[model samples]
Target: MRATLIEVAPRDGFQPIAPFIPTNEKVAFVEAAHAAGLRRIEIGSFVNPKAVPQLRDTAEVLRRTAGLEGLDAQVLVPNARGVALALEAGARHIAYVVSASEAHNRSNVRRDVASSIAEYGEIVSGLPAGVRLRLNLATSFDCPFDGRMAEGLVLSRLEALLAHHEDVEVGLCDTTGRADPDHVFSLASACLARFGEWTRWVFHGHDTYGLGLANVAAAWRAGITAFDAAFGGLGGCPFAPGATGNVATEDVAWMFARMGVNTGVDLDALVRLAARAASLPGAAPGGRVRAALLGACATT
Candidate 1:
């Protein structure tokens, strides 16, 4: 099996941290991700600077990586203003988020389900040519406030989004890590059965309960080919309580490589990059392969 892993450390990993990472260091991390064979990366978000201070320099970070060959940068946009900023930064890939839980969506984006879907319709209709927009269904499996979500409810939301745009890219986020392997597989299968094979689906899972890798396997088994992972497993949602970092990029890469699946990522380089990410302030690397390889190097 082959899959494409989208690095989300720069954006999702660092959002909840207090100390700000230097812009140069952020760019270096992105460069290292490219070197590790990650062609697609979520570098930063275009939300209000005051809300996510760590990503205030999103434009600068995007600017620094503009010339990297074969690298595609995707930035999260919360609204029309965010869309404007991302466009100004020359970003070609833009992702808009809407939680499956109505309460969660209201809290995260300050809009109800109806309003949020309206906003998505506006963004998709007004987007310039050659730019791609992705809709992320946060809390697809479960919500902190609403508990477990039914797969049918998630599909309904996707249907609403698809009503406005055709052939859209959608990411199913296990927001607080509440989803088990069975839940992940069932939801993924349900979504695919209803949406057909042409709908591009990406799985984003958190490691809050240590089931991130297990959930990833379930999603893969259900025919999902794209995944989102943060370097070192550094990620957390500000709106969701007890939410932890995403499944580590190196961890997922290591698992796939050992399973005889090709991910096109160099494990050695990813391990080195994970080390650097772990050294960053407020960042932790949760991937076992990185620690094991570092330990091996120290003993020799």
Candidate 2:
């Protein structure tokens, strides 16, 4: 069987860094990811500059990387205004995020969960032709502020969001990186069993507790084909205290390759790109495969 890996280092990985990455550098990374065999990438986000100055040039990055052949350049957006900005910048794929936990939702987006869901409906209703929508349900498994999310609560929230539009893709996010493999498997299994036909499901996880890859494996066992990972595991939610970087793209690719699953990612080239990402100024990059691969290369 094959799995689809979506590279999100440019947006999710870069968003937490305090220093600004040049627009050209961001675009260049997106281009390099494409060359490295990543067909889908979350390149940047459209949010208030004051809140996330690191991604202030997302629009420009979108415009610059728009022509990469076969690249599905996706951008993260928070609300209707963000969707508008992304659309204006020529973004056809937009990911709108809303935390499932009420407290985390307020902290992340300054709104309640219901409000965000309402806005999602509004965004879907006004979406133009040729545009694609992806809903990222942050804190789906665990939240820094709310602790582990209940399975029932998650299912209810997912139902509400999917009711807005079933054609969209949905991602279950472990925003705080605190989910266990059992918890991940349980929730993922439940979700797939209940809503498998409504929309496509993607798993987004972090490596903070060292269970990132384990959770990914569990999700895959539950039939989740698509996943979101960052090169060098560079990412964290600014609002989710104690949260860390995502599961490393190279790690996921390596695991899948060993499992005889076709991920279509070139691990050697991905490691090279990850090394560059790890060395970024003020970036908190995590992951073990990059170092392991480098050591192997040096000893050889």
TM-score of each: 0.97, 0.99
Q: Write the per-residue lDDT of candidate 2 for residues 198-267, one digit (tens) a residue.
A: 6899999999999999999999999899999999999999989999999999999999999999999989
lDDT of 1 by residue, 1-300 (tens): 799999999999989888999999999999999999999999999999888999999999999998999999999998888999999889999999989999998888888988888989999889999998898999999999999998888888889988898678899999999899999999998888888566789999999999999999999999998999988888899999989889999989988988988999998998888888888877755656678878999999
Q: Record all residue pairs in model 1 with backbone atoms less than 3 Å apart, i.e. clashing.
A: 235-245
Best by TM-score: 2
Off by over 4 Å in 1: none
Clashing pairs in 2: none
lDDT of 2 at 214: 96
Tell me the TM-score of model 1: 0.97
Cα misplacement distance, residue 21 of candidate 2 (Å): 1.0
